[model samples]
Target: MPIVNVQMYSGKNQREKDILAVAIIEDVSKILSVSEEEVMILFTEAPHGK
Candidate 1:
């Protein structure tokens, strides 16, 4: 199982997040020779505030 963690500044809409997730998953699957279902993708959206 391939686990991927992505962190980005919070400002993306739902569509953007969905697109990003799918793109990341596809790339990881191809690189690791694993199915998209087998890959784990995590996105942490953080605000630029204290």
Candidate 2:
């Protein structure tokens, strides 16, 4: 199992994040020979401090 943590500035919509998460999970699963369920994804959002 692998834990995927994505940290970025808060701006993207939920749909975009969802799509990216799924894409990452699929690629990680395929390359690691693990099931999608075994891959854990966590997204951390922060302000740009602009």
TM-score of each predicted structure versus truth: 0.84, 0.94
TM-score of 1: 0.84
User: How big is the positional error of residue 6 in model 2, measured in Å on the Cα after superposition?
Assistant: 0.2
Clashes of each: 0, 0
lDDT of 1 by residue, 1-50 (tens): 99889898898998998898899899999998999999887889889797
Q: lDDT (CA) for every model shown?
A: 0.90, 0.97
Question: For candidate 2, lDDT tens digit of each residue in 1-50?
Answer: 79999999999999999999999999999999999999999999999896
Once superposed on the true structure, which residue ranges of model 2 sit more than 4 Å away at CA?
none
Which candidate leads in lDDT?
2
Candidate 1: residue 11 Cα off by (Å): 1.1
Instruction: Give the lDDT of residue 45 in candidate 2.
Output: 100
- Model 1 CA lDDT for position 1: 92
